[model samples]
Target: DTVSYGRIFKADKQTRIASVGIGYADGVPRALSNRLIVKINNKKYHQIGRICMDQLMIEINDENPIAIGDEVILIDPNESKDLTLEDWAKLTNTITDEIICQFTTRLKRIEI
Candidate 1:
């Protein structure tokens, strides 16, 4: 879910961020740390800092006003219009198939 980063000491800046409940433990490659981007409400936002065991934070700008349960697009699988699994493959210097297969049992799949 979304969080305001470092509220105790860094409250002045009020950097909005979303900490997704998926990370290296969920088959997310560690190489994607600080390099991945996710889409929220069709707008792009870069991931910030290192991706942890079970979460990754995306920087949300001031105007976006993201909520706790807003949809987050991790990999679209269609590179023509948005970030895709292949994109992540490139970032990790691996193949798309590996990228697709790397996701662990920790994730839940929903069929459309």
Candidate 2:
């Protein structure tokens, strides 16, 4: 089945598409739709299709043990340098501070 608002992603076979609880409205760029890769359980998965206002979708294999409450990391500097704000800024052709500031209050901020 196709996924997201524009149906931009279609799996080659039957696959699980997990809807992450954050998206454009949460400061995730729409331009990062197909370009973003999120980490879950130390495994990276591509953010597929056109990003929605409140959520995005990721393709998951049937073999993956990901569950509803599993943590999905959008930008984890410690995990992978590639997942940092600087990388996202480069991908979106913007400054890191701009990217950082774009995130809305809808998302919960946790200081580590």
* lDDT score, candidate 2: 0.88
Per-candidate TM equals 0.80, 0.91
* Candidate No. with top lDDT: 2
Off by over 4 Å in 2: none
Model 1 regions lying over 4 Å from their true place: 1-14, 79-82
Error of 2 at 88 (Å): 0.7
By how many angstroms RMSD does model 2 differ from the true structure?
1.4
Best-matching candidate per TM-score: 2
lDDT of 2 by residue, 65-105 (tens): 99989999999878655688988999899999999898999
lDDT of 1 by residue, 1-112 (tens): 2332332213246676667888888888878766788888878888776677888877776586678888888888654543887788788889989987888888888999
